[model samples]
Target: MIAAMLKVMVLGVCRDRGALAMAFVLPPLIFVVFAAIFSGTSGTEMRLKVAVVDEVRSDETTRLMDAIANEPSLRMHALANQSQQSLREAVAYGNADVGLIIAGALTQDGEQSPIVIVADAGRSMAGPILSGHVQRLIASQLPGVALRRLIPSVDMLSGGLTSQQRAQLISSTDEMNTADNSKSITVGESGAGLFRMEVLDGRGNVTVSYYAGAVAVMFLLFSAMQGAASLIEERSSGIMDRLAVGAAGTDVVVASKFLFLTLQGLLQVGLIFVIAWIVYDVALLPHLMPWLATTVFASAAAAGLALFMASACTSRQQANTISSFLVLVASAVGGSMVPRFMMPPWLQDIGWLTPNAWAIEAYQGALWRGENTWALLTFLWPLALVAVVSLLCAFALSRYRLRLG
Candidate 1:
């Protein structure tokens, strides 16, 4: 029975890519995704780096930060400059996973003193999880004194109990604690601009932040490898020389491949986005212009990379072998396979050199965060580097052909 079941399962997986991916890939991926979502209250225990923005300077704030510092779920780090802009950069650059800002104070009925709590929702799960823990800890410690004083006294005569017994019971219970305030408002200030800042929201920021970097990087590698395949195919068929026999030299031949592969990359990204929209319900065009611009650059970068790889390789098999290793390795390091948040700090720092890492960041920023084109800064440098590399590859290809002895 076991042997038969194994055979059936293998056959089933072999029949379909989606089924195979779902069976072999989806389970672990799903587990990781769920883990990211509901890991624990003490996110510090998971080793997340958090930044503190303390707008309210009080004992309560101190206690909250202290509790956070002691937690294993987080590594509370900070930008030396402590400005909002600096904090945003820290989060964006992967130096910090969560950002906590103690915005202001709040006061309740008949209380002159303002009770301030944490106000930021964080870039990662640590933000909200840490905020919740901080709030609970602060409420438990600070509200204990006030609740104790506010316990009401009920008349023993009305309850048919002896006055002494009733008084004794009330004293014992009152000794525990009471809550002066009932409602638990998470934020201490207005919720306007805060929600908009997160990289991936359902509206597109979060998904874009994650997916854009993910897709651009992943597909760019694939496109380049595919472009390299053409070189092998051309050599196999003698197409390179037929075109090179005319004024359409190797330069023109390489240019055409670059242009064609870029178009293919653009189409692939478009299809992926469309499928994501229909399947995952990711918002496609929140800020249409920036989103469109991101797609264009991502396609261009992919093509340039493909051209460079193709021009350098000796044959399709060699290009395929080399490009495959490059793509998989780059994708692994650059956050195509796993979330960058979970990687070690040093590794995350290294991922910055990859185009996928930056492209995903920009796509996500534009798609989800309502970020302007400036978010594309992370992408532009990598893309520009590829273009320069491709041009150099073109020059090298000319030299290789001139001496193809």
Candidate 2:
């Protein structure tokens, strides 16, 4: 009996093309996507976009900027004619991951540090990562500058250095700088005091807000897909035919399902965020209006996508397998499972196509970043359009199925 049942199960799965693909093909594909995304996150291969403002424009700062531009880990853009404010705006609006301002001479003594790193609060890691790169460059490419800065501290601590000692130190630094550029020399000291960090839109733990939005959209997609699976059951049981022939019609059936799924998704998002507020203190109430708008559009998009998937699938098993594959893949690529910044440039560009990306961005902007109405709309409109197009497609597919039946 065990052998017979095993054969029966295997035959059933083999006969279903969707199930076969889901069982055999989905795992490797998902593994590949995840590998490509996560393998570069260890700082060696991660490429960060850096916007630079050279206010001093001195020879030392110019050398520093050129070294940064040549770095493999950083994609540096020089804002030659732009101000530090422009660089800040670039980081704020996502034009660059982080901003650098060389406000003074590298070796100059002043009340403020010569370097400034501007970063967004949500992507808090970017600031530190860029800081590390800058420090590394200063130590390796600009050893003279590093040595000059160190001399002041040394003089302060030791009372003074003789002219001969200072001259010898300066000669060593110059020789190190003029040495083979390929080999990097380690400086025991850190460049922490050489730069100040300016974090933008920091409000009540932006990391918590990011995860709240990410989890909300991901579970919303899953819940909406599960709820929409009822269409497959109804069709299989002849209820779809009865409803199609009645005064209500199949259109009403699909529309009603879409509405219910949308409402279900909205409730799911609300509950998740309420917990986030209670436990994580994610600043939900302050931006309630835009939050609500983003929630509604996100829910509608999930519902429409779910309906379209359900309408196209012929069986519950197929729908389940396919929906799971798609939702997981989309969530991974969409910055829900991991921050998109951690992914390589190509994968990050692909994330923009997923609804999870837009929903997360909109929610983060509305709640954490305190973005204006216009900025919020840029993220919201894509979700609204997805809802409209998917709903129309699902409706047409359902009507076609009704005619065939």
Models 1 onward score TM values of 0.63, 0.92
Clashes in model 2: which pairs? none
Q: How many clashes in candidate 1?
A: 24
lDDT of 1 at 341: 64
* Alpha carbon lDDT of each predicted model: 0.59, 0.86
Q: Which digits, one per residue and each the tens of the lDDT, describe model 1 over residues 132-226?
A: 55555444544432332222222322556576765675565334323334543332322211222343223633544466448666976687578
Stretches > 4 Å off in candidate 1: 1-46, 63-96, 103-124, 128-202, 242-245, 278-281
Candidate 1 has an lDDT of 0.59
lDDT string, candidate 2, 242-342, tens digits: 98878988889889998998888888999988988889888888888889999999999999999999999888888999899889989988999888877
lDDT of 2 at 404: 82
**Best-matching candidate per TM-score:** 2
